[model samples]
Structure formats: structure tokens, C-alpha cells
Target: MIKQVRVVLFLVMLFTSIVLLSSQTSAAAGAISWTKPVERETKQAIKGGTHKKQEFAFGDGDLYWIHQVTAGQNQQPYVVTIPVKGESATFRYRAVAANKQPYWAQVSLRDVRVLPAASGFLETENKSVWLGKPIVYAALGKGTIDEKLTLAPPVEVKKTAGGYVLQVRLPMRAGLISEMWALESAEPLVIWGKESLEQIWLTLDVTDQAKWLYDGYYYKSPSTYVPYTETSYWRIPENYVLRSFLYTGGSKAALDMGYVMLKASLKQQEQQGYWKSLPRSQWLQNDYGISEGFYDTRFNTGAAGMMLKGCALYQEGEFCDAAKRYTLFFQQHAVSNHYVVEGTRPGWLVADYATVGKKSNTHVSLNHQLAEINYLYSSYLQFGDPTDKDLADIMLGGIVNLGSRWIVSSGDLHYAYFPNGTFGRTDYPYLTYNDLVETQRLYKLLHGMEEPTIGKLMASKLAWMEKNKVAYLTIK
Candidate 1:
């Protein structure tokens, strides 16, 4: 009898301790929780569509709506879009009611890592596409791996007139590289966190380069995505085996970094034999018997060319040379004379204007590629080697001369495309983040030159795309 009583008492004490610990843990850390999925919908009715609040591991302090925007029969626009804060790795919470019902909650990035302090926004000329503010990645010097993993301080935002200021002081982690990296945004958002801090996981590649290259955008390790860096701006092909996004959401600076990797690849080509095109990694097509590729594919021509043109504006000798090669190289990537790009993933392919509808019925990012290459080719001609004007003209002409029908206009608000060309009512969406600055700069640069009336008119359209953000931006 006494033994039974003792066992019961012990169990009671253990239960009390567990309850106390649970209560204390809940009291600490401002975490979010939701039981049931909250009912939500988009403000617009689409061409006729609905949006649902899909809880996901978006970026820090972020939420998303996973929707199937059906424009017509047999066509479904299944998209997972994040908030104005853009993309962030986040833990999602959903409750049918407030905190009253049984909820579903996840733990990942709280999305607190996104957004910028007004002072730290993309500090660049016109806040161009794919620009990187100078960031120094410091590796873990002499600490145990455990010591490097510590919590960082908080990130805060303050509002003023138009926009508010964001303040962030994030920690760096160390792993394979000596240094890690950060991102540059079209807005003033700053990202620094405990996991990516230099004191944590940092490493240098085989050539002694810093590990930041592998520390890509969404913290997707180089082992996953083709190119490591800010993958947040774009996504890998669903066919790819990547389980995580190296970088989440749209980041212009990350695009620029990808460009740098390409230039470096060109320089390294003469020195190394493995990467004839892909710099730090390899470009492998299951169709070809090329050397098996590496996990990092950031230096592909399409991505690289975009970065190269942006760099050509300033980095003269080496930058210009690399940008030129990248421009021509992009020509090699098209399918059947169209500018649609191909690489590790088919979805990553960017096609020439009007190609998406005329070529096939599949939903691909053809316009996205057109918008990217149009600016890149134009930028190279205007800023870099003037000798490459003929080459630029050829490609730029291809992008613009897709069809003769009147398309929607490129406004400061959104991208416009040909509505009457029989592609249905598809409108050219605005290229926010990196795409905007690149297009605008390229347009203005081209506008300054003597081109055909159509080209000049096109340049005017891009200018509107550049300035349209004024209405949406708080301008802090």
C-alpha cells in the first residue's frame, strides 16, 4: 500500500513540474498560434477568382494566400502569394475563430526577419533591379558550433511621413564558409538573423572564396538549389529535388549576386576546365553528357546576364567584358528562336514576348523572361560596349516585335501586354523588386539614344513602370 502511494505521489510531482514548465514557456517568446484555418478571401474578384489564406512557412513575419485563380476553363492559376512584406520563411497559424477554436499552427520563420529600416533600404542609383549594398560576411572565428547559435535581438519599424524606418541588428552564423551574406531589396528592408549570422554557419568554397555564396537567399543551402543566394525572388522548378528555398521571395540584390557569379565564372573559365559556362558550379542537362553539375547553379546565362548588365553600368573593364559575354550567351538559351530560357528547371525559363501564348498553352513565365532580357539587352547596348549595339538591337527587337497588336501599356502601376492579340485578356504584370529597376534603367538609357519610334515609345512605357511605385510606396 505504501509503495503504491509513493508511486502516485511521484507521478503527481512530475505532472506539476511539467505543467509549470509549459506555462513558463508559453509566457515567454511572443509566438503565434492558431487552431482552425481562418476564413479569408482576396479583395478583387479576379477575371473571376478567389483567394484563400493558406498558412505556410513564409518568410519571417509573413502570411500568404494560396489560391487557385481560375481565369478560364482548364486553366488554373495556383499561386501562393505572400503579403506586401514580400516573401519570408514563416510559421503559419490558422484558427476558425480567434483563439477560441482548435487551431493549426506551425513553426518556421515568424517572418520577423523581413522588411527594412528606412535608412537601410536598397541604397543604389534609382534603386535599380538586383543591386547589393556592400555587406561584410564574417565567419565563425574561434567558437564551438553551439556558441555560434544564439538568439539575435529584435527588429523594429517606425513610421514617419510617407514611409517608416526599419531597424535591424541581426546575428551571423558560420558553417562551411568564412563569411555569410545578406540581401538588398527595392525597399528599405534589412535582413539579419541568428541562424544566418557569421558567428554561426559560415564557410568558404574549394577556391578559398567566402562561404556567403552558398548562404543564398532563403538560407537554402547550396546543396539544394542550383544557385545559392536570394532564391526568395524566384522559385526553383517543381521538378527539381530542392526541399527548401535557398532564398525566398523577390530580391534584386540576389539577382545581382547571381550576375557576379557569372562574371567570375567567365574569368575562371580560362583557369579551370570544369565549368565552361557555370562558374562556381556546373550546368547539366539530362539531355547532354556534360560533367555532372554541382548543387549551385546561380551563374546560368539568363540570371547571370541580368546581373551583368546591372554591373556594366559601373564596373568597367572586367564587368563590361563579362556582361558582353553574358548578353550573347543568353541568345544560346532560347528555344526555337524564342527568348524562353532553359536550365535546371523549365519554369525558370523566361521566354520572349508573345511566345507564351503562340508557342504553347502551358503556363510559363514567358513575359517574365521577356521583361528581364529586354532590359538586360538594352542596358548592355546603352551602358556597356557600344560595339554590341547590333547584338542588342537584334535581341531587343525580338522582344518587342513579338506582335503588332496593341498591348496593355507598361504603367507605373502594373505591366501591360497585348490584349487584342488573341492571347485572351492576359495583362503584363509589373516587375516589382529587381525587374522594375532593370527595365526602367534600360528604358531610360535606350530612350537617350536614337531608336525607331516604336522603341522610343516602348521606353516611355518602361518609365511609367519605374515611377508607378510612387503611389504605392510610402516614400519614407
Candidate 2:
């Protein structure tokens, strides 16, 4: 019996030793794959130091903002070359920070379209970036990654209270594509040495026990809804918002914008003397996201959101209270960083969730980011967060740094974004749908600031709105 026991022990020890060695070897040969898919088309933030750029695709709708380069609040430049289909386009993302680039990085596309994760846009011999620029082949390439990008299965999810909850362990293989850039390849391929781990290859994220996203890094959350739906876009809510993968269009904040404003309106009346704003029943005014329960005007529009919140702060008179109360409401609900969606209207354009950026159906590029930042600044003035001023300053500084990057405006601080500011000089003739209001909001926002120049400009703009009988800042 003693001899048999000894032999068994030896065999067990030998097997254990082999298994341990194998496990250690596997561990040593790898790093975590699948980072957060943060490459969206927005204004990107760049750190002061040197870094490489990451390239990826986006669904066509509006742009989204992803990627974070935080160089302790100064100023830096970020240049991205978007390759769509067979054509390549480039844009510069510039920012200025007081302590760190608070917000950074943007992904861009043109006339882009998106479909579900399981399947969407893919051709027999194609894998282009956002601007139709064909990908280059590497010496040891594994062909195309379109199918892998398009056909990758999603981790199943189920809904729960509190928010959609998900715990995922992504595969390392999913993070990489076999190097396929060939010298002979005619496509706009990667010129070796530009491969940057910082600009992660695949835009995905993983969840685990201890540490995870939104822990310490400065980042922005995607919006309440999406026009370009992707497994990636949906992933944020699935894992963070709740424990379920299905939204069913039944979200916690499912009130049509108007109704939500009513809650804000009560706050507005209690603070600001102005109890009502003009009727703005143009497009989807009376409709709430849910049933036939129509939401009143004092709640939904960006103006109302800010006005109500403003009132809660500056408990002074009409302008003071109305502006403060509404400003706060708008700040809380400013769109998410994710903009690309897959469907059509009825499913309108949206914006980012937490951080300030382009809100869908509102506008695109500088137009939205600038307006939201201005609104946030107004809230800062009415409320008490000095930090908001810092953020707003960074945004404005970034635009100033970009100088002629955007198109020239017809009004004070209003500009267009055509190749060299030569697009349209006559008040931009065509004020994109969400233009006037945002610009007016910016005027009111700056007027609240301490700066003389910006304040004066904002005042002049306000004058223009009234002079034009424009329903500019709707809070009145």
C-alpha cells in the first residue's frame, strides 16, 4: 500500500508541474486584447507629447468621438487620415487644456452608413476606412478583416434592474488582425513603423473583477440613443447601464423631450419669474418618446433644459432664474459621445451622453461641440462649478487654435466649415436645422462669462437674434 501511494504521488506531481509550466508560458506570451471602441467622429483631444494615430471605420450618420490623449491640460494637435472605400480624407483635431486636454480624439466619415453587428456593409474585394480609402497590405497579412469586424458574434445579454449588467472576458484573437499590408498592395496601406499600440487595432472593451473602464481615465459616455447601431455602440449600455442587452426603446429616461422639460419647467417657474417659453411646435414638438402623453415646451428643447437648470441657481429674476434652471437641465442631458447609428429618422440623430460633443439631429463637427460647450459654460456661471469654466475655455481655445479650420459665420462667432472658410460668406445662407438656437445659446453662454471680448461678442449676437425676431434663445 505504501509503495502504490508513493508512485501515485509522483505521477500527480509530474502532471501538475507540466500543467503549471504550460500555463505560465501562455501567460507570458500575451497581453489583453480588445480595448474600448472609442474611435468616433468628434473633435479629438491631443496630449502635448509625441504619439501615433489609430485608424478605424465608423457608420455613416453624424460623427462620434473616441480615443483619449490627455497631456496635462495645455494644447496639442491630432491629425487623422480617414480612408473611406477608395478615397482618403484627413482632418486635424486640435485642443487646448488648462491642466490636461479634458476631451480628445475624434473619428470622421462621409456619407457613411451602418447596419447591425451580425452583418452590414462589406464588398467582395474591399475594406475601406471612413473615406473610402482602401487598406494597404502588409508583408505577412491574413487578407481582410471586414468579415471579422462585421460578423463577430456579440456576447449575449439580458436586462435587469439598476441598468444592463454584463461581465465579459474577450478573446485576444479578437483584438488583432494578421498583418496583411503588402508592399505590392495598391491600397492605401500602412507604412511600417506607424503601428501604434496606443491607437488600439480593434475598438472593443473587456470587463473583469477588479479594475475596468471609467475608473481613472478621462473619457466620455455614448448617448441615450443611437442612429448607427453596432454591437460596439450597444456594448456601452449593455455592460454599464444595465445587465441586459435589449433596450426595447424603454429606457429609464423614456419621456419624449417635451415631457422631460415639464419636470424642468416646474423648477423653472419656482426660480425664474418667467413661467413660459414660446410655442416651438415645428418638427417633433408635442411628441414624447412613449405614448400619446405630449410633453410641454418648457421641458424638452435645449433652451428649456438650460433655462430650468439656470433658474434653480440664480434665484434672481426672469433672465437669471430661467437661464440657470434650464442650463442645468441641458447639461445633465447633453448627448453622448457616440453618434453613428444604423437606422433612419423616427430614429433621429443623437449626441453623446456625459461629455459635451455633437448631439444628433442638432448639427455636426464644431457646430455642435462648440454650442454644447457654450451651454455648459452658461450653466457654470449660473451654478457654482468653476471647473466647467475651465472645460468651456479649453473648447473655445481649441477652436481658436484651429483658427480657420471651420467655415466662416454670418454672425458674431458664427462660422462655416468648408475647405478654407470660403464656403459661404453671406450669413452661411443655409443655417443647418439646429443652427440658430445653438448659436444663440452660445451668445447667452458667453454673455455670462467674465471675459470682455467674448461677452461683448455674445451681447452683439443676442442683439442680432432679437433684431431678426429669431426665436433664438427659447427660454424667454
Candidate 3:
């Protein structure tokens, strides 16, 4: 009898410890839990459609809603929410209209404020709400102002249980609704508790780079459906894969995708072996690609660096040939003081940016120059070529010569580099997150290459990004 009693006691104690440990872990992680999904019908009835529309809202600090207009149809909109601990809540939605005609939907969030301007009232002006200052009420689609999806006021907010329901109406043009109803909205709202960010990040599967790349918006369009970044930003396809690679902290799969994208980009290379800034297919499809004109130094050097990183990561000889070819092409084009120019002409693909803009003129971009040096150094690391290293050093000097032109306010890098000569007012700027990540990446490659000055600058940038809570784990 005593033996049986002892066994029961031991079992009870073990179970109690397990339960306590589990709860402790949960508390330590600061996990966020989803509320039971609440289904709410649209504010008004559909005028002529046979289908009744309903919106299902889920709360994880911020509200996420799925508008089901055609419940029976399989081609419903896809809204993916990536909640980071700080910064904005990234909501990527794709709304496909069933009609073939020009279809349009508008998304609005009413009665919201950025700061407290009035005690209990939201000030409105010309369809925009004023918190401390006036902001447009809608989260516009990633399109030009005159485009069907890109309206000035798209977001409208209404009072909810605790906060507000940000309603975004997406309007897609007729017949093109199915193709055009895709956008990522980074709505700004404050959610309490650290778990809000932790839960979302923890739920992210580390191996799923495609999903991360799609959600992260590190790369612009055509590479992914909805962008994490702005739509107008033309980036090398390899940059997205590089983002996924760094986000995963050198995951083998991301490295593989980087190889795949670079190889695919190589196919887009013109007869002269230099890639056009946008792929031929993308140019044929989108107006923005055509408007940007062709070729930029960022695209070529960035792509070459991506290929070299792949060669180093995978140890494949296939990438080595392409890397060498690209390096040689860059060497042949050294126009002024080993600096490559911005735009290119048709036949010889000569540098010429004036055709694109009235004021735009040919010049070296500091970012692109650094990007080439990054590639050259990587090639040196992979092939042990002294010449590549020498070129990298030479290019570094050119970049340093332009350092006084950096947008330094109060003795800090303002993150914009002159794309037009050093005298121009319009320097191509980067997103806060991208700037930090790029610097972090530069630091990673240059730390052991006798480039302490650049490393220190990168370190400062990284610190600033982290202090602002804008440094995501990938950059860290």
C-alpha cells in the first residue's frame, strides 16, 4: 500500500513541474494569442450583385479582416499579415474581381489618428484625418496617383472595442480587377505588450524564404506579387534572394535561390552580356518598367556580387564563369576614375541618363560603387585573384572621394547617395531598413579585408537602426 501511494505522489509532482515549466516558457516568450474570429457584414448592402459580402476580422493586437464577397468562389482575395514587434503592421492583400469589366474597390480606415490632436474627436480635412497632423484616410494601392487602385484617400477608420477598425476599400479597374487587385499596406497603429511582435516572429517558419521574401518586401515587384517595399523601386532580382539569404542567416535554401535568380537574370542579359535593368518580360508587361528606361549601375554590380556570393556559398564552378564575365565587363566600362556611369545607350550600351529625365545627367552612384567593390572583394575571396582585390581597393578610393557628398546631418550618414554627379540635389535614397541591412552586409564582407573605416560606418548605421527599432533580425 505504501509503495502504491509513493508512485502516485511521484506522478503528481512530475506533472505539476511540467505544467509550471510550460507556463513559465509561455510568459517568457510573451506570446500573442488570436481572438475568436468575429464575422461582420459590410456597412452597406451590395446594390446589384447576387452575392452578399461579409468581413471576418481577427485580432492579434491589430485587426486583420478578410472580405468575402463571393463566398462560393475559389478566387477570393489573399491577405497575409506579418506583424513585427515595432514599426508598421504589414498587410498584403490580393483582391480579384470576378467581372471581366473594369472593376474597382476602395479600402478606407476612418476615425483614426497618428497622435492626439483633439480630446475625443478626429479632425477631418478633404477626406484626411488629423491626429496631431493630417494624414490621408486611406492606405492607397502601390500605383501612380491617377491609376485606378492608387487613390489619395483609401483608408477609413471607425471605433472598435478598444481601438479602431481600419477599412481599406480596394478598387480594381474593369476586366483588370483580377490582375490588378494586389497591394501591401503598412498601417501604423500602436499595440501594447511585447508578445504582439514575438508571437508573429515566432510563428514565422525560418525555412520559408519565399513567404518571408514576399512578406518582407525586400525586393520590388515581378520577383514577388505584393511588395514589402515601394513599387517604383527597381531592384536587381538577386537582391530579394540576398535578403532571404541574410534573413535566414545564410540558410542553404536562400543561397540556392540566390543562385537560381542570378542564373535567370543572366538569361535577360543583352547580346553584349550586360543585363537590362528590368527583365524583357517585365518591361513588356508593366508601364513603370518602361518609364524607368534601361540599365543602371546598381543592377549590374549587385547582380555580380550576388553571383560571387553564390559561388562562395555553393562552391560551384558554374557561377565562377559568369562572375568572371561580369567582372571583365565592368572592367571594360571604367569611364572616369574607375567609376561606372548610371544609364546606357542602345548600340554600345554607353552611359547616358539625360534621356530619362530633363535634369538627370550621367554620374557615378556611391551605393553602386560600393556594390561593385563588394563584388570584386567577393570574387577575390572566391578565386584568390590579386587583380580583383586591387580593383576593389581602387573603387573604394572613388567611393571615399565622394564621401563629402553623403547626406550627413549632425555628423551622421543620412542614407542617400548621389546618383547624379556630386552637385545634384536628387540623390537616390533607400528605405530605412534597406539602408541598415545593406550596411550590415557591407560590414560582414569588409570586416577582415583591411577596411576598418567602412566597417565602423556600417556599425554606426546598424546601431542607429537598432536604436530606432527598425533593425529586423536579418540585419542584426
Best candidate, TM-score-wise? 3
What TM-score would every model get versus the actual structure? Answer: 0.31, 0.23, 0.41
Poorly placed runs, candidate 2 (over 4 Å): 1-301, 304-306, 309-367, 407-476
Q: Pick the lDDT winner.
A: 3
Better of 2 and 3 by lDDT: 3
lDDT of 3 by residue, 227-277 (tens): 223322223333443433422322222222333344455554555445543
lDDT of 2 by residue, 1-476 (tens): 01121232232222222222233224312222212222312334333422222222312222221222223333422322222332222211222247532222332222223211111112112231111111111111111112124322232222333222211111123222111110111232222123331111111112111011111100111122221212111111001111110111121111111122222234435232223222121222222122112122212233343343324322324434555554444433332322332222111112312112223222223444454555556567556677556555544554444343233343434433232223222222122213333444454555553443333444545555566665332223
TM-score of 3: 0.41
In angstroms, give how far residue 180 of model 3 lies from its true place.
Answer: 18
When summed lDDT is taken over every stretch of 10 residues in candidate 2, the lowest stretch is: 237-246
- Looking at candidate 3, the ten consecutive residues that score lowest on lDDT are 126-135
Off by over 4 Å in 1: 1-302, 305-321, 334-336, 339-387, 398-429, 432-476
Q: Count the backbone clashes (under 3 Å) in each candidate.
A: 73, 94, 35
Best-to-worst order by TM-score is 3, 1, 2
Q: Residue 236 CA error for candidate 1 (Å)?
A: 6.8
lDDT per model vs. reference: 0.29, 0.28, 0.35
Q: For model 1, how does the per-residue alpha-carbon lDDT over 1-476 read when each residue is reduced to its tens digit?
A: 01121232232222222222233223211222212222233434433333222222223322212222222222222322112232233222222236433233332223344332111222222121111121213222111111112232233433334332334332222221111123323442323344332111111111111112222221222332233333111111110101001112112232233333333344433221212222121222221223222211122333344334334332435544554554454444333324332222222233322211133222223234444445355545546655344444444454345423323444322222222223323333232323333443455566674334234434444556456542222111
Under the 3 Å rule for N, CA and C atoms, how many clashes does model 2 have? 94
